[model samples]
Target: MEKKTDVMSIRVNEKIKEKISKEADSKNMTVNTLVNQIITNHVEEGTVFQDLDFTSVRKQLLKKLFNSMPKEEVTKMAGTMCKEFFKDTTMYLYGKYDLESTVRTLESWFNSSNIPFKEIKSEDSIKMVIRHRLGSNWAMYFETMIKAVLEELEVKTDSYVKTIDSFSFRAYY
Candidate 1:
């Protein structure tokens, strides 16, 4: 138990004082402590600095840049990322230009990592093939998986998505 000595009193609406006292009682806190905390918070918020410091602003910009790269870099990064992401799984890609090059790079990396892959022809207008050892419903799986990977790489390729044929898994040898 502590003894109270010097006390300061301030006039307030009777109803407000009663409400404050009730809240303090509910929280098992002294009314003076609760009022002090409220006043401190109010003062601090009222006097909050509005300026954004250069270091903090610069850090935010760098964070945004790392999170998102230029479009060309993202395309190249997507190829690198696909290889890393599907290292243990089978994957296949078919196209003529950039997509073909990207997939070839990934395929080489996969081969070097001992992840087996096989390319099979598809009867579609788009150059397409099935991969090896992808399990079931692999077409849908691969499409979604690849899209997600590209998104992470910050590469947008929805317009060219129709160029991809059926993506699936075959034998795993």
Candidate 2:
């Protein structure tokens, strides 16, 4: 352990202190170490910063531009980009990407990228529901990404509905 450089103190309710101590013990950590880590994380990274804020604005602007393009053209372009990103997964997937595993991978990607979606899988089909906050264009963009990934995996969609802020898609294996 590193030597302490500075000391600080604050008062907390007895119940809160007890809860924190119990949590630390449950995790097999010292209360002081757990509290210090929590405080450090709060100070160092409180929330999404300026760049992420600007990213949403940028997406809005780009969506407007892409909306002017032909729908098929824009979707194809987005699909092409997704294909490149997922191309190297051949070895990881053991040469073929099955429908459930492929969509599961997409689900994980959506989660880590902060895209809100609900995916339900069954033996026959997979349903993907996306609640896009940006706009219809972004929703369509994700739909394109999905269609492209399914295409790459050799899965075909049975039905799909694209609206202004949500995408409901069902695909078969």
Candidate 3:
């Protein structure tokens, strides 16, 4: 027995159709096959990955490792580095990963550091809202420490950190 291919017509913008055609050609697939595969994927599986929370894994693993290390040493090193790295910026420790403990450790490490905000975790990723007092360089340094600490923890996770502008919705009046 052979499955019959039924002819279906769909209207789409010319530009979109052109782009789809190009992509299909690049992948060496016919338009019909590509569309069928997309539909089949949606129907068969809801998503590609099952359970992968990179952000939480990173935070948890780092928190564990840092907690294990001697607090005084990390604090001394961080304090010395902070003088050269961030002089005027207030470090706002944000994220759902153990805020109280992490803040305490960081405060102990850096004498002048301040924790202004903490983001609660509901789903997966953690968002830190650090004020721009330290400027972009300070933010970059903080981001570097975040990655280094997470890497040192050796957690099997992947993450994406980005700085985004305020999001707003507009309506036509």
Candidate 4:
């Protein structure tokens, strides 16, 4: 027996409905069937790929390749690239760079990206600590990125970073 489908009534512009109908005709499917398939795919794809998001997989794989090389060399090369990249970003153009604000923004970013971190902040310094998971290298990239941003903003900071058992850093601004 075929699965029963439910009806969903929506109000779309006539032109939009016509476009959908045309697309459905091209695919040899009814408008209803096409819309159903599109909506179903959109809803199910994320659940299917939840823990295996593309960025996570790509970074993990790249880290394996990167680990074979000299880390100090990578640290220097990537830090220079980051500085160049930030020098061209809109953030650098706007030029309202504050250490406290940047720290808060980075904290929010790490939290939203599901990267676990422990941080301590004070009037002149910020410390960030993160686990060096089996296939992720967050230390060098983050340290360089932060340093580059500071340089672009002309904020005087002394940065110390170490990536041993875990990635940890202290930045005095």
The lDDT for every candidate, in the order shown, is 0.45, 0.67, 0.42, 0.61
**What are the per-residue Cα lDDT tens digits for candidate 4 across 1-173?**
99987777999999999999999999999999898876764464334334332234454665676676576766776678655553433233234446655665455444434566788878887777765452324456656677777766677665465564356667677
- Stretches of candidate 3 exceeding 4 Å from the true structure: 1-112, 123-125, 156-173
Rank by lDDT (best first):
2, 4, 1, 3
The number of the candidate with the highest lDDT is: 2
List model 2 lDDT by residue over 106-157, tens digit each: 5544543456888787888778887665566666777777777777667878
Model 1 Cα RMSD, Å? Answer: 23.0
Candidate 3, RMSD to the unseen true structure = 19.8
Given candidate 4, what's the lDDT at residue 8?
Answer: 78
| Candidate 3's TM-score | 0.29
lDDT of 1 by residue, 1-173 (tens): 99565666889999999999999999899999899867754453223222111122343453355345554555455456544544322232222223334455445433433335555534431232444232323233345556554454444443222212334332111
TM-score, one value per model? 0.25, 0.53, 0.29, 0.47
On the 0 to 100 scale, the lDDT of residue 78 in model 2 is 70
Q: How do these models rank on TM-score, best leading? A: 2, 4, 3, 1
- Mark the regions of model 1 whose C-alpha exceeds 4 Å error after superposition: 1-7, 47-173
TM-score of decoy 2: 0.53
